[model samples]
Target: MKDRLAASYWLHESQYAAMSSSAVTERRRAAMERFESEGFPTVRHEDWKYTSLKKILKAEYALSSPFSEADESETLEFKDIKRFLVNDIDCYRVVFINGRYSSWLSETTHQGFDVCTLGSAWKKYADQVEPHFGRLTEGLGATVQLNTALAWDGLYVNVPAGVTLDKPIQALYFTTGEQPVFTQTRSLIVLGDGAKAEIIERHQSLTEAETWTNAVDEVFMGANAHMHWVKLQHDSPSAALTQHSVIEQKRDSHATVHTISTDGKFLRNNLDFKLVEPGAEARMFGLSLADGQQLVDHHTRVDHLAPHCVSRENYKGIFDGQSNGVFNGQIHVHLDAQKTLAFQENDNLILSEKASIDTKPQLEIFADDVKCSHGCTVGQLDEDALFYLRARGIQRKEAQALLMLAFAHDAVADIQHPSLQAKLHRLIGKKLGVDMG
Candidate 1:
């Protein structure tokens, strides 16, 4: 693994060196050094205890490179790619194929606000990219550093002060190839004071070939800003994904993030939120549906650093077959953060005897005037509800599916986009082998 990574670094050395002697280049070099020293995380790490990378580490994966127009033409067609997209909605779309940006399939804008690629931003607007590029991810873990060192291209959005985007921005990443491969993508979003925007991010594999994606995102919200972000993970069963997102909110800002994972062989998500100023509010919601031999894990942390701040976290999971699920949520209140209110809850449903889940919700309070609480539950479905549905002239399978959907209703309801929410409902129903109608 180290040899492959070293070769990749040298292969892209020219590209990295061409960025000029700037802070971004220095940060990239530092990240490369850190990843080289720490390497990939293992079960020995406390946060990674419930997840393992034995299989992914052992498999040989080709690193992604720039794709040519001919390669794109031979890889996929718009007709086949449209199925992975959400229809009946107007969105600024940014598409990437095999880790390279596809301008032909994208709809970007820079008239009033910025909706473009990180590579372009780095080349064209270095001043804007330098200040906040590597600021939030300084002491993050190894995988994030790996992404910083090797990321080819990703979405970048900047909403100016008091501006509200008319439609959401959809960032879609699709993997298509005949060989086992890996891709690292990075994104950054900045919202000025009183700005508002909605963003949707999705990852999908167009083929059954083994693929691995390591993605990282950093978001900064100015005072009085509002942002809604959603992550939908529905890759092929032969694919694996690891993603980390860091969000910072300023005074009077509000942010909400929803992560829904339904398909993959192995998946892990790390989400961190920092309330940097007074009156900040944050909400996080997650849902994982694991079947077959899949594994899904989520680790989240919310930090309350200012007075009069509030945060709420809720996560739900449904496991079937021999799948496994894990959830670890933590909320921390600083010593000076008085009048802080935080709550966290995690619940799971095991549908098969072979299925399993591990849930831990934790809270740490340092201020005397703070209110914080956390709870978790792991159990099977309600027998009474199942019986009631079965007796009402419904098949057992459909009844179970209906009950599962109802169980997940709260988390799905938090989604603000109507079209995306409807699409998720249909996908969830299809995954459970039932008609949602």
Candidate 2:
């Protein structure tokens, strides 16, 4: 299977060579070699013990081709496309259909900052993208390497020093085709020193056909830079997605990431952060709601390499029916990372007897002056809280929804954007079959 999949990329090698820079071509070749050697990860792998890729690997998926004139004619209805967009937001939009950028459905800028596709960045802004394009994925796993080798187009944003983007940027990837296909995408976000920016990412499937997405993101934060990133995953049950995000923070940089997973057949997210200099801060929050034999897994790691750095992580999960959820968080404070402060918490609620969760929060503190702690809990809904809400004349279903909302409020409240927060609340309410108002 590994040989067959690796050989498939040879079909696109000529196209990739023509479109990509020499540096990118070399990186792709190296990544493909690495993937060929490592192959797919299995349950035996410690990092993938709780998740299985048997079904995903068994299915034959057609690789997406580059966008062309014919693809322009395959259009979707406005009403259908509008449902996936965030309403009432004055933000720049970049939309991708079938793993290809859709210029008609996108709004991008290149005047002050770059809001464009990775292919364009590689060709037009080679000087700015070459250094950090594939630097962060040096030691990543096989899935990421596969993406690096086959990924054709994705979003790219660069914020210059001391400049704050006037509005947020949204990157939407929509899958719509006749047959089941696999799409690989890679995104790069670079923020210069003292720069501030907010980015939103989403993956949605327009058709019920089985589709798999393998994506990788690399974010670089310069000294004193600030970034807020939100990822929304609410695709159909036939959609399967695996995403990995690598974040590198310099001195005094701050970054916050929110991952909200409400729907999908199988979802696996790997979030890794590295604090390269002192005084850096990293925050991670995640919420997952799964039902009907679905699976959602989150693996996160934070590395403190310098002194006086801080990191915080909180993740919550709600599983119904026979669904399964997993959360593994690791915090490592190196010997040189003195006076570091780190905390991690993972809490889960099972709504049915068949529902299950596996949570592990670990902390490794090698610095004597650092303070670090980690904890996790898995349990059912709070019966007492549900009863209280029922006693107040709320219906049983409404009361359950209210309780679940309250349980997830702590993480939702951390979102700094009011519009985005409100949108998420509505999405959560819709998923719970309740009215948040």
Candidate 3:
């Protein structure tokens, strides 16, 4: 499998290297070398101790690339993909089909700010793309290296100082092909000083052809900038996803992230926040519903490199029917990061006897004056609460669903958009087998 992927990389490099800038091509070569050396992580790796990629690595996957020609042979239209989108929302859209950009279905703009593909940014705005692209994820995990080696097109949004986006931006990626394949997506978001933006991202498979996706995102927030991001994950049962996101904040910048995972065969998320300046704040929330032999893993890290920074993390999970879930969160405070405040928590409810969860929340503090705490819990539904609802003439299944929804509500409570929040409520209700009106 490694040999085949390496051959594909070389073939792409031989054909496209001359067209790209030397600096950009060098980065790609270096990243490919790193991936070749490390390959994929196994259960023996420390960061991946609880997760195994044996099933993913053992299968044959065809790599897709482009050299000035469209690789999409499947015909699609806006009506064909309308159902996968959020209803009753006015937002700018960016859609990709089988790792290629779909210009007709996208409504990107560049009037005051830039909202387009990373490939376009490389061609038109090299000065802006060179400084931030591949900077945050240069020496990270093997999957990140692999994505950097091949990904050429994805979402790119650059907002100028003192300007706010008119509406949220939606980035939708759909996989469709007859054969098993792998795709790479890399996105870069840059916000100038005092700028604000909101973004929604989703990935889906249109067919049951066994698709795997590796995505990487790099976000840079200037001073006093605010950014909100919502990620929705509910792919087909034959699909798998691994996403790595890095957010860097300057002085007084704030970042909020929400992750809702309801369905998939395998899913893993790695989120890292670097508070490089004082008074920066980071907030993260996640809710996961796993069932029927599914595996979901979430790992997060926050580094307090400056004083007076604050971070908070909360994640909830519900597992049933032999599913397995894992959560590992870490908060680190440096010696110079005095007066840092950090809190982390993870709670889970298991509904089946065969289901299980493993959660670990850790805090490492080196500062003399800092307030930090971490905790986790793994248990079943509250029997008393279920009984109380059932005694009011509610059906037993309905009562259990209501209690579970209540437990998972806090993770999505901070969302600002009513339409997006309503859509999430419906998705949660569908997963829980009840109507959450």
Candidate 4:
């Protein structure tokens, strides 16, 4: 796989030598070299100790390029795409099919602020794109480096200073092809001082063909800016995803991210937040439902670099049918970051005796006056509560499903969008095999 990736890099570099600027090209080369040197993370790597990539590495996958113009993406219509979208919402849409942009299914704009594809932004606004494209994701990990070397097109949103978007933006990526494919997607989001925006992102596979996606998102929040980002992962059983999100918050900026994963063969999420200036705050919430031998892993980190910063993380999971779950969360408070407040929690419920989970919540405090705490819990459903529900004329399965819904409620309670919340409820119900209405 590494050799194939190396060959593909050279092929792409020669094919589109003029696609990017000299500096950007150099950065890509550097990233590729780093990836070649480090390769993929193994079990020996502390961060990836609980997860294994043997299933993905053994299979031969065709690497997808954004410059490919041979895909049959135009055949899709609103009906085929509506099932994956959030209904009853007025928002700007950007759709990509097999890593290629689909104009017919996308509604982009540059009316006041720019909300369009990163490919167009690279061509039209190189000055702005150059400064913020790969700024936040340098030396993060080998997978990130691989993405930087191969990424072509993804969503780009820039809200100007003092401006607030009236509606949210939805970015959707669908995978459909005849053969197994591996795609790399890069996205850049920038919010100026006092600007506010909301974004919803999803990746889906339209077919049963095997597909693998490596996505990286770099978000920058200026002073007093606020951002709400949500990621929904409900792909086919043959699909796999490894996603990384890096967020940099400036003075007094606030950023919140929600990750909801219900289906997929294998899923791993890496979320990192850096509070670079004083009074910045970051919040993260995640929920995962794994069944039928699926594997879901989440790793999160928060760095308090300045004084008066706050961060909170809450993650929950339910494992059944021999599925496995892993969670590793860390909160680091620097020496000079006094008056910091941080909290972390991970809770999991095991339905089947065969199902299992590994959770680790860590905290490192260098500041003496900081208030920080971390904890985790692994348990089963309350027998008393289940018996009470069963005694009231409810079936065992329905009663268990109701208890699971209540267990997963707090993870999504912070979402402000009513329609998205409703859609998420429906998805959860479908995953649990019961009606949540």
Q: Which candidate is the best by lDDT?
A: 4
Residue pairs with backbone overlap in model 1: none
Question: Please, what is the whole-model Cα lDDT of each candidate in the order they appear?
Answer: 0.86, 0.87, 0.87, 0.88
- Pull out the clashing pairs in model 4: none
**C-alpha RMSD by candidate, in order:** 1.7, 1.7, 1.4, 1.4
Q: What TM-score would candidate 2 get against the native?
A: 0.96
Query: Considering summed lDDT, which 10 consecutive residues are worst modelled in model 4?
Result: 66-75
- Show the colliding residue pairs in model 3: none
Candidate 3's displacement at residue 228, Å, is 0.5
Model 3 spans with C-alpha error above 4 angstroms: 14-19, 68-73
TM-score of each candidate?
0.96, 0.96, 0.97, 0.97
Give the per-residue lDDT of model 3 (tens digit) for 1-437. 76776777888795546545667778888998999999899989988888887767655776756653555554478987898887577889999877788898999999999888887787588778878888888979899988887867889999999989998899998887787778888899999999999999998888778888888999999999999999989888988889999999999999999999998888899999999999999999999999998888999999999999999999999999989898999888998899999999899999999988888887788999999988899988888998899999999999999888889899889989888887888789889988876
For candidate 3, what is the lDDT? 0.87
What lDDT tens digits, residue by residue, belong to model 4 across residues 1-437? 98788778887895444666767777788889999999998989998898887777765676778556646643578889998887688989999877777788999989889889887777587788788877888868899999888878899999999989988999998887777888888898999999999999999988777888899999989999999999998889999999999999999999999999999999999999999999999999999999998999999999999999999999999999989999999889999999999999899999899888999887888999998988888999999999999999999999889999989998888999887898898789888877876
Q: Which residue runs does candidate 2 get wrong by more than 4 Å?
A: 67-74
